[model samples]
Target chain A: MGNFMEWLDRRFPATQVWNDHMAKYWTPKNFNFWYYFGVLSIVILVLQIVTGIFLTMHYKPDVTLAFASVEYIMRDVPWGWLIRYLHAIGASAFFVVIYLHMFRGLIYGSSREPRELVWLIGCVIYVALMAESFMGYLLPWGNMSYWGAQVIISLFDVIPYVGPALSEWIRGDFVVSDATLNRFFAFHVIAVPLILCVLVFLHIVALHKVGSLNPDGIEIKENKDKGGIPLDGIAFHPYYTVKDTVGVVVFFIIYLGVVFYWPEGGGVLLEKDNFTPANSLQTPPDIVPLWYFTPFYSILRASTADFLVVLGSLTAIAAIATPFIKTKRSNKIAAFVGYGVIAICLFIFDAKWWGVVMMAMAIVVMFLLPWLDKSPVKSIRYRSLPFKIAVTIFVLAFISLGYLGMHPVSALSTIQAQTCTVLYFAFFALMPFYTTWGKTKPVPERLT
Target chain B: MSSNEESSNGDSTNENRSRRRFITGLTSAAWAVSAAYAAVPLVLSMTPSARARNAGAPVEFDFSKLQAGQMVKVEWRGMPVVVLRRTPAMMAGLDEVTELLADPDSADSVQPGYAQNPARADANKNEILVMLSVCTHLGCSPVEKLAVGPDPEMGEDSKGGFFCPCHGSKFDLAGRVYKNVPANKNMVIPPYQYLDENVILIGDDEARNA
Candidate 1:
């Protein structure tokens, strides 16, 4: 073993690489429950890819056979039901883990200056994961899958000039037929998964580069001891690896519990409508997207011609109020320009198009969070009360939107969703003001 | 160094640098052009194939078979096409909901010029509506509520139109979208022309003109 290690060290830097990433790598010792989700996300990703690979072995992409093929896997193939359940439920679990992981970042300021690229890469992974799950949802070729693809692909049609042609190109036919199914299968199985693996790899490398942030959001590296080891830091391998194992074991008990007992997740993980074969002539009475996508889906359904008028009036009010805020000259000017541009867009584009834009913007806005926040300190512990109140309202609005998107549309729900959509944007739009507005507690020299 | 010597040395270096820059620029342009050339077939391969295009040819429907206030559905280009023979009462209902429509004139909606009127039907047969059954919102076919009174799917004071169950968008007898629904425009009216007094061909108006 010594001889082999010596030979390998001359050629490959195997030990060095291990020391850099795992064995000797120092991480803060103050990690808590919120830290478990990062490792859980990796666990779910690996579970999805492995189970997904096994599923593609028995799954057929043809529209005629796809639905039956899924049923066959559930009924005929050996242990195939377990694999299918894992993959299906794992998709939703992945989102749950990811959303919590992201919330951890928001509260802890893991996306602050040095870690901005890590957060950006993480946001991209979230988007890619959504695409992967969306395409994977279609491989069953069930009624909900067919119509879901129809609605989502039609979103591309809201573009002005090449909208029709672009959507047709995406479908590879006039409708979501066998051609679309086959292409989506190729993407779900190979193309997107490949991109996801690369992105996850990049996300980890970026995270490691900046070092992990703890709940206190202090840089442990800044207060290193004589040997250059952070005083509060512990070796990641023996410390975090063991701690994360406990999290993984606990996560599996609950995950496998859902898989074995209630894999359908009460029609949110897997919709009841998807059990039937697709028919182009009919649509399900209430077509809700999966639970993970409900918030953005609600945003898409909230926009109307009157909604545009509401948005225009809001923009006008903000534009009128821009002069009263005590800020830099440039920020006030930027506020006016932003409101002016939105007001003009309300005239130039239809509300249907704005619905698509807003749905996409809901995700895109997260990419700007690191810059949008102008707080003097990191971590919610040291942040002001206004910021705390804003975050509370934002989380409440997001949860409400998610719940509302799962049901059929009604007058009350539409009004509720419209209000939530405004609050969702207001969280980011007002971040610069509220983050810098109130009194911040003095950060302690060490983790509490 | 003397000024002349420095100038001569700078001139030779400038000539060599310009030569290298030109070669690099030319190579980059060639690479970009070839990449674009390779992408053309790759991108075009994802469009509708020849077989799909061939299957999308114009379909003829005999509208005379439809009774009053009844509708017939046919497949055109993999989409449902509804040919409805509107009763006089249903035609009059379209006028009642005109004030509540986003585009009562069919002005931002799609149709051939001959079908762009309030009825959204060919001028020769104004009561016969030939529109794509696909909802303008997300392409799900709308459930027909052609009755003249209240409906459970529609409201108590409903004007009797098509209702999309997915997102609650509504359309009148002429296929014009309602004012405050998720769908912004009316259902599309496919380009069609009369073959006979009771038959209409859907999906290829220019071919007959040619």
Candidate 2:
């Protein structure tokens, strides 16, 4: 075995790669419960792909046969229910793990400075994962899946001139039909998964390039011993690998519990409307998307004519205050231009199109987090009181929007969502100011 | 730091360098042309096929059996086109609710030139409304609440038309969109024409215009 390993090492960097990534890789010893999500994300991705492969074996992509085929998988295919449940439950678990993972990064300032590329790649992975989940959701050919695809695809129709044609091209027809289903199946099962794997690989490579940030936000490399190993760091292989195994065991207990007892997650993981076959003629009384997407959906639904005016007024105030703020001359000019453009769009375009824009911007904003945050310190442990308050309000607004999206829209709910939408954008827009406003606690030298 | 370093040996002349660069540019242009050629079929493959397009050909429906204050749905281009025979009360309500509509004149909405009025119905058959059932906001079909009084789904002062279940957008009796809803424009009226007193053709208006 030793001789074989030596021969392989000469041909390829077999042992070298292992040592570089695992055995000799130095990670901070003070990792908390938040760190488990990274490993759990990988585990869920694997579970989804494996279960998806099994589902495709029995699944039909044709619109006519697709709905019945899923029922067949549940009733006839041996242990197919387990595979289906695992895939369905795993989809929600993936989002739960990903959201927590992103939240952990935000709190620890993992996107700061050198780690920006890591965070950017991770954001791309998140977008790709959303596409994957959306396409997968349509594979069941259920009532909710049909209308969900209809509503989402129709959003493209709000674009200026090319909107109608763009949507037609996307749907491969005038409306959601067999062509749409077949193409979505192809993308869901093949194209997106391949992209996701590549993006995840890039995310990890970028992460390892800038080493992992600890809860204390201290760089372990800054204080290496004479032999070139950090005192507060440990080998990732024997230490983190064992620790991640424990996380996996605990994750499975909760994940499989949902699969066995509460796969529907009370009409969240798998919606109750999805049990019936798709009918285009009649829409369900209250059509809601999956839980993970509700926050953005609420943003889309909140953009009325009055909401546009509100947005314009806020932009006008910011533009008026731009000269007084201590920013670069170029930044002031850019802010003026951006505000002017937004004001013009508010006048020219319809509110529905702006809703689509707001929904997309909500996700696209996260990609700019590295630059948005101008805090002197990294972790929440060292962050200002104002920074913590902003984060708290942002999180509450996000949760409120998600809750609103899952229920039927009302006059009161629409007003509430519009208010939350303002708060959501304000958190990102005012981040630099609040982060630099209050006093930060002194960061310790070592990870404690 | 630059491509000049590779040619530091001074073995290559300027003419030789220019010729090499020209070839490289030509090769890149050729590859771009080939890629564009390859991509045409890929993009075309995703658009509506001949079969799907054929399915969208004009639909003819006889609405004689459709009673007043009742609506019938017919499929045109895989979309629900609702044809409603409005009662006299509904027509009177359409005029009264002009203030409540976003586009009462249908100036910014899609319809044939003849049907671009408050009723959103053909000129000869002004009491009969023909509009695409799909909501202007998202594609979900709105449920009809054709009454003129108070009710749920339609607000307390109903003046009822259609109610979009997905986003709560309301429409008047003529499918004129209510103000401040997610839908900005009125519901679309398909390119339709009356073939007879009781029969109509949807999805084509060429003969009527000519």
Candidate 3:
């Protein structure tokens, strides 16, 4: 029987994927709530993929009839309604979980050194997820799918050549037609799944390779007096599993809270007119994206022209990509300068843009990170005030965006959006100026 | 002693005759249920209740009224199905799609247990084959596109597939839709068991013989 089991194990690959190299892990004590987000993100990704597969069975993809078909699935097909909600809510949970997970990296300096690739891979996964979600949003074939694709693809039109023809080719017919719908369906159901699966594999590979980072910024890798056995680290199973289970439950509560009670996640699900088929003749009354995107879209919507719009768009990209730059160990003075710039960006963002400017500034810090960490902290006792301040700035900016997103006045919304937009870009554009002189630890060799 | 033996013989013969009559009654009872489907329903007013519409329960139809080449709509619960008697051309056209159908043998498609063989409906060139019109792709009603036309967007090789009026997806006459269409499976074919020459009941166990 044992030999049979061994043969079975060899035939299937799960044993290799989950055992030996992966199962041998240690988690430090005092690792905080932030440590759990990475696992939580993984959990949500699996849930989304499973639900998404079931949903594809019932979804329609033609421009003429996608909306009504979704309604049919919701109304008639057995258990289909549940599957649709599971997928929609699952998507929102994915973004929320990832944001927290990203925060964990930001707070603990997990993006530094040997772990930077993990952070970079995480960023790559996030970008791929954004593409996946965008393609998915198009599949429902509602007015938003039509207009959103119209508006977004139109952004591609900003490119110098192959703009109009490219858009025409993309739509397949003169406009978003049956061909476009079917093709987008293919991309959403098949192409994105393949890319996402690959990215996820890489992201986990990077994460496992680095072990984990803790809140104290201390390595739990020291040995006992004999120096043979681990003194602090614990195996990830049974130890962190107990902790992650709690995190999982909390994540589910929030996930269900959004799915069951307020499934729209604030007017995003079943966007009222999205029930209607795509009609180029009429536009949706309010053209907001899913809530996860409103903060960035708000930035885009705030500026009215070509150049400013370009700036706003660039600012948003720069914001999401900032961590890559801010964690570098090369430029202490500039890193410290980046610190001040980040804080000022946040304060000015709150006072001026109502907070978007701060988030944008923080994102600039992220891009500069790979080149910024000149700090030579040899001991674990050194403090990082500038990074702390930068993180604080980021939080303030995030709050500002969320708050202004909820604001009723159109003018105030536009102002808040534009204010954050400028500070956001300025933070990135000004990064080279700041990173030349950041602060750092003295020297570990001469530690007192 | 001789009188007693004669009385006993008389009783044995009477019992054997009674037993034969009972066996004959049981055979006719089974036949009556199925025969009711095959031959009973042409008498319009004598329709069976919903309870009688069991799996492969013979459904009675008045073929007397249905026009050739035209369709008659029937309801089983809330779902709608079309009962059509194919013209010689329609049957000939079905042959054209023999290669395209994922399961030309009707391996996985639903039908009456009695109609297990190829062509699904019991007997070849039969007047009726029941089909559920709902598209397997999301339950949208499929519009019939019987013949090839100038669909500029459809590929040159595109045979007239039922175009989903909702999404411009197309399916052939045999109910085999294209690969890229939203639907993952072909339209459903309901089970129909035939009982008799003119009086056929739909949805019965014609498979009892099989």
- TM-score of the second chain, each candidate in turn, equals 0.80, 0.84, 0.55
Candidate with more favorable, higher TM-score: 2 or 3: 2
Q: Tell me how far the alpha carbon of residue B29 in candidate 1 is from the true structure, in angstroms, after superposition.
A: 3.6
Q: Best lDDT goes to which candidate?
A: 2
The per-model lDDT (C-alpha) reads: 0.90, 0.92, 0.59
What would the per-residue lDDT of candidate 2 be over residues B1-210, giving only the tens digit for each residue?
466776664437888778889999999999999999999999899999999988878999999999999998898887888999999888888988899889999998888888888888877889989899999999998989988888777788888799998888999988899999989788898888778778899988887868
TM-score of chain A of each: 0.98, 0.99, 0.78
Model 3 ranges off by over 4 Å: A4-17, A222-229, A268-270, A304-368, A373-383, A402-412, A426-448, B1-210
Residue B87 deviation, candidate 2, in Å?
1.9
Which stretches of candidate 2 lie above 4 Å from their native place?
B1-8, B11-26, B195-197, B205-210
Best by TM-score: 2
- Which clashing pairs does model 1 show? none
Please provide, for model 1 over A55-174, each residue's C-alpha lDDT reduced to its tens digit, 9 standing for 90 to 100: 989999998899999999999999999999999999989999999999999999999989999999999999999999999999999999989999899999989899999999999998
Q: Where is model 1 chain B poorest over a 10-residue stretch in terms of lDDT?
A: B150-159
List ranges where model 1 is wrong by over 4 Å.
B1-22, B60-67, B122-127, B193-200, B204-210
Q: What's the C-alpha lDDT at position B65 in model 1?
A: 78
Expressed as tens digits, the lDDT of each residue in B1-210 for candidate 1 is: 699898777768978679878999999999999999999999999999998877878999987779999997888887888899988888888888888999999888988888888889877789999989889987888888888788866677777889887778889988999988988789999988888888888997875467
> Candidate 2 deviates by what RMSD?
2.6
